[model samples]
Target chain A: MQLNESDLSWRSLPGTLPVRHAVVSREQLLLLCRDVAGRGARLVSLWGEDRRAAGVGYVLVVVLDLTSRLLLTESISRSPNPGFPDLSQLFPSAGRMQRATHDLLGFNFLGADARPWLRHSAWAKDAYPLRHDFVAAAVSAPPLPTEIYPFVRVEGDGAHEIAVGPVHAGTIEPGHFRFSVVGEKVLRLEQQLGYTHKGIEKRFEGLSVQQGSKLAARVSGDSAVAYAWAYAMAVESLTDTQVPARALALRALLLERERLANHLGDLGGIGNDAGLSFGLAQFSRLKEDLLRVNATVWGARYLFDEILPGGVATDLAPTALPILLDSLAAMAAEVAVLQDIYDNHAGLQDRFHGAGVLSAKLARQLGVVGLAARASGQAQDWRAALEIPPYDGFAIGSVLAEGGDVAARVAVRFDEIAESLQVCRGLLTDLPSGEISVAVGKTRADELAVGGIEGWRGPILVGLRVAADGRIARCHPHDPSWLNWPALEHAIIDNIVPDFPLINKSFNLSYSGQDL
Target chain B: MWKILKQIVRTGLVTEPAPNAEPRLLEHALHADIHRLFGRALCIRQVDAGSCNGCELEIHALSNAYYNLEGLGIKFVASPRHADALLVTGPVSKHMADALRRTYEATPEPKLVIAVGDCAACGGVFGEDSYAGLGRIANVIPVDVTVPGCPPTPTALLQGILAALQSPTSRVDKRSASTYQKTEDRG
Candidate 1:
């Protein structure tokens, strides 16, 4: 309420998600963050862009997830090593985001934690890949010598550090986990990610806005539909393109399917981590059945390119309905039985019950979003909260948990699977008949727009700026992992080292999304 | 226990037949040949070389009831030293370039590497030798087989592993490669 329309000139950004953007001064920026924090606004994402090309200077953008809408504040810096008052004191995740912004673009945030994130042996100290003037060829320059990460040491007797990988034992993404442990008891867990940073942000630059959708889908392979939808929404808004109601409904269908697919897979992985191979076996089979159906109905099994810029690439075939409906019913029956098995199983419950307890108090303080946030009693589901477009047509409600433990996260996942299934069925049954897409007219230059869609992980926000010639001037896709990853470090505190995987899976924050 | 057993019984063997082994004569003999010639489990160490986890999804699916990779005497081991083959995914990122090399070196001799997905094959859309290394796993290490897809399906992955197993030598025959020559260790 401190940032009222009367007090601040908030320009509404056109998109599905409720967003109001404004450029403020340095002192006002800090005051605004403090005000929002008091009003229970969760910090969604913070990113910096080099607008020096457009002669606007270095811009640091912070997105705040207010109860019903998103408030974006931009503070500009004129000179080198530009410093802005850090909001990490109010929101803990801001520290890492600030560090990442500094790592990519040379904007500094005045914070206690100034550690370099997403910068490995890939570049030199002075190299800023996201800067407008960064040469593309220089990215392939000779690898720099390794710099030892200054992980905070636990200065106590019997405390030792155990370092896990950027390259782990399994077929999982790369990230380094440093565990400060005493025997099997974990004192603290600090993660240094960026092994997956293949310059996804840098690759986004100079690409025609039309081609950006394909790249966005690959941002995090799992959330392909979400990223694509969010990107498309931004583009559509910027171009003043109004998609047909049917296309919006289809987009919702695809988004829900994407959620169902991820929840199914992650639920299985969670069980697998907790020593339930039976769960992994059964759930994964269910997932495969789902993917195979996707293959038959849609051309791709993973549905990587199913969602395009203007609308969905392919419309639902007549045969897809009965098949999809039957599959959902069968999967629902099997999942319900599996849920019972998991519920009654003594050992599985024992492992999940109290491990990695991220209290509701801490959860809100850290500004965690998505399913992870909901598990800890933060009853903020973006779909239900905003009710944007197709979602507005239906009554979607938040599925919440108060336990803030591994078990709570699992329960939320189980409930979400059922909810997503119901949502998908509703969308399919109430099919809207119309054109699937419309031609997005000429790209408008110098327009800054934001798009947000509730992906399976969380609400993904993309702050897009078009260059003078209609190319992507600066596009920053902020993943929910930005807020949740730091929460993971806190969640593992005082827990045993062996339980880390199960706890980590409960949150399952994206390394690629956060790194990019 | 009875409920669990009932569920297991109801969902009986869902594993499909493995992908194409070779010509008519080699069809039924592929599984038997592994036992007859190698006479051990084909252990694989999967390294995600900066993938979006799309390829990893399929790789993980290989272990599902439908694929049941373990039933075929193939296991995804934790350590590279214990692995007979390395299944790598993604266009190798520069940050992960050294780790990939170290992993390649750590695996004992007579190792087979199968690059999964299009990114690892020719770098896919990211382009070769750009921001993210050579964009192909073969550029960093010796690749015995390559499976192409945005993310090759689990069945395709099973076939790639089997294909790598059937190759006469551990390394790919560079002369046979038509698209691009001079793999780091192409014979």
Candidate 2:
């Protein structure tokens, strides 16, 4: 509690989770951010909420992850002048979050990059979508011609810019990337996302806490289980509802299965991007088999809507347990074989060996997480660090690689899939017996709760505030892609254009997650 | 290469045989006409309007060894200009509305558009009146067929594409003109 002694008058918030909150003037906010960073706490997410309906004007929340606990800092700027001193100068990752805050809520982060990040000419300049007074029904006109964004220029010999996709050649989400390259080498990479921004944050307003879980699941599809669990954790904490041990174990199972499925797919994708079609065919087949088991056991290929607040929507069937165990065993064996092939393949080795290197220095600076962070030798796995419920008993091993190359990322995925398989098997072997779900009581008004889960990608943080009538006032689901995406821009520098796909696939940051 | 060959030999053609084409009664009736038009191969161009990437994962699964969509003479083309059909997913976001229209117009004439997933079919949970989403693919572009689910499975997506190809002229009679009207009005 380094922030406890500050003259800022910190207030302890009432919630089940361990968090501290303080309302400071805009000037104190800068000093607080600097102090927190100096004490080795990383800024997890920064978002603005329009509280004018509550007569509190606009509130900006900054969430920091201090390894063992979370520190939440808030400051209110009145409607007449909604501006705050920018903390991006202290934490580089805060720049985009501040810019996004400006775009969606009209909260100006002074001295930060004021360029719009999420506002893509879909609305008029003064019409902020997240504001309480902003009407969602008034935007009926077709999208206007998007103004040509002035991308940072790199004027030098042979440094022409190449712009790619809001739509891509492959079956993926829409995101535009601007590459400033000198002949074959990339000088800089700029990503303009939010093509998939569906006003999800605003859509969460006024929904019942139970219904909000469904919206949270869709925030990023691949990590649905994690997001749902995180949302459930937040709601349960706010309401002080105790989730059954069986439900907690089941959630751990689903989260690990998600990790395995995504890693399997990415391993194949990395191989395919490196020109090994065999890996694509083989790994995809394995992933499909895994999904089939998911269909049989969990009743959906993607495991959508399975995790509900208080507990799970469905329990693992008695008849399906052995079948699931068998499949996990088979998939583990197959993956081991694939790992050997990937390691020995000359072509894949040549392509993956030294490409898209993100130094440990750069990774720490950008605060990259998940497999990307692990690949760069940063062991920031929440399963190990946070020790929440099932993960604590499992003793989940930390996977790390130093090179941060495409190969290192691929290796990390392989290690993680194997680790998750073991964890899943352990959870099944000692299946806890109890009620799968319990009734969650009413959430207290004005109570703020934070939920963090180590999704396959990394740690996903969900910050929730309950309205006066026990409905959701505001929910911000922060994906780890926020920190990891900038790392992609750095990883691409000095790499060739053709290698971009390979590097990007290795990182595999989510556009849907980032955009939302 | 030998190691790969050895592994392949051990695996021994793991691909499943294509499922029997038990077209729905309506699809069966139009299947003959579609067969006469496109013959064997179908070139598809997928457009992601504003999905959570759930549908895209299932759609990509269609190309795996088990499903083997390419084995069925169905290929996903890189360019819309070379496509016979557009497989769309997600609710049409405002930012992507124009791009979705342009992709539709870029495809050759007599093109089929199949909306996959609940989001594309009817905006799913986000709904039509949200500030960012337009609700359904049909609201933005002409949808010949729609396969609805939170994210429809790969088999369902395949069926939706096949059904759209079979009944190419079925949905064009009424909504074709209005699609342009909506686009023009919005623009």
Candidate 3:
């Protein structure tokens, strides 16, 4: 990979770019990231603004490495309107990221796939919401603006398109999916999301760093702990602040509990969808029991508003220690019973075995990550890979399965639950005695940092840029769903429409999370 | 038949509790009316206008063992016609306005509307967003109960449903409400 110390007239920070400088041209910047990406670097964040700096408008793109955790910045003048060479050709998943950049900012990624990732008719054709000139309080955009969106269609005698949701029968998130199907089998499934898009990124523009963290937590309620912790990590890194040992442990504990709760509920629900009510009953009970223990130990059942900037809101009580141990013991036993049932049940096995098979090759090609990826034999888990503090203290074993099917996903969850329970038990036994939180002092302005955590779903990454007055300049909480959502469409290809719920449940991609 | 019998035998005599499972004693306590309404069967139909899916997750979680609504007479019906109450979880999207109204209309009389989550209650964070206009369920339909939470836990949803069934201290005269104050529907 090539490295350059190209000069940028814009602001520069110590840890931002490797060389304490930025590339002047967008081409050089793109090439630098391209080189690093070619050498197997996962670009974490790409963001910029149309700033009137030095009497000129400029857009910057910052990319980071998944391995080194280093940041690189690229800037170009707005006059030439330079576009980054489409990294989508190099990384298929980059298509969405590049498309998002194109949509929000006016910057383009040349020769990228044509489909707009999030341009879901929410705005007019010419309107760019992320632009500096774009008014925040604009009530309406011009109506009936037509734009082309490409979806590969299958032509046959009796084939038709089935448009589902944006509004669905079941209580779920809104996302429009147009399915070209013949009979029960789906030929192609194209998704149109951003129906619940609340302009969270735009709203984060002027909030204080601490308040921005609260907003990050709400990006997706299910992964609130992950998002909050990520934001905290970013800010802490910016301030070069090291959180206390006890606070780190508490955060880790909460994170594990969050993962466990979500997994149990999802595992059970997937089973229920497959007509295995026994799994549903048992797993759901375990999940509920776990959440109750959480509410008693922590404040909330879903554990909302517990995680704050520097550390947690409240400390785990000395009285609650033994209770947590007992709850963990109960969870272990109950999970064992459910696993036994899942293992031996012929009907459940039949339904789960080969259904929704996502091959390992396809998973890699599609850049699928998280448990869904792990189930399909992609053994990368960010918590273990990144060697974050509490996780560093523990032996984090990566779970994998060769089957790449619904059964494999179930097996992965079962393994993860066991591991999480074990981790929780370990935490309880080795529970630290100290203050749960420390007061996070006022954040310095122009501070930018990146935070990442291995959430139950996958890596929850957040990038925070604080303005001069300690308000947020930009805050982007990237959910694992951004990488995993497309995998669902591919996984459902040959599967019948009747089993769509099962497949969808298995992945459980968050629409709000992705939209943010 | 044999399989069902064998399964029942294996599971050991599955039936509704003789003295009620003490609904409030479950980890997250249920409302008193819900405790009384336990095993008093009624079908529930859920409507989604535009939610973040948090409320839906809790609703799905309700079927699990700890606060199993099935143990009480509460059931999630597949069809609106079969339902006695409508459990709406969303901010009432402009696109879904028609479908939500139609579903409510399809439900039988003495129907209850239990708006689940902060989104359904007051649109929560998504309240002021462009797409999610008229944030609460009460804005669209006459809501009988509101369970305020970023997605209230399953127990809270149960409580809300129970609260809906209970007789209110002050009731609006229906004749006057239908004609004059139709615009002002209190949830």
Scored by lDDT, the top model is: 2
Q: Which candidate is the best by TM-score?
A: 1
Residue-level lDDT tens digits of model 3 in A361-458:
88877778789889998877777776777887787756888888999998998899888878877777786777776666666665456677889998
Model 2 over residues A421-503: C-alpha lDDT tens digits? 88989999999999999998888788668887899999898989999898889999999999888889999999999999999
TM-score of 3: 0.86
Compared with the true structure, what per-residue lDDT tens digits does model 1 show for residues A205-286?
8888887888888888889888888888889878888888888988888888888888888888999899988888888888
Supply the TM-score of chain A against the true chain A for every candidate structure.
0.97, 0.97, 0.91
Winning candidate number (DockQ)? 2
Q: Model 2, range B1-187, lDDT digits (tens) per residue?
A: 8878877788776655444464344344444554555664678999999999889889989999887787666799998998878999988888788789999999976578899999998888787878777779999888889999888988887777666655545553234456667779999
Candidate 2 ranges with C-alpha deviation above 4 Å: A1-17, B17-35, B168-187
The TM-score obtained for chain B of candidate 2 when compared with the true chain B: 0.80
Assess the local accuracy of residue B11 in candidate 1 as a C-alpha lDDT between 0 and 100: 94
What is each predicted model's overall lDDT from 0 to 1?
A: 0.83, 0.84, 0.71
DockQ of 3: 0.30
Tell me the TM-score of model 2: 0.94
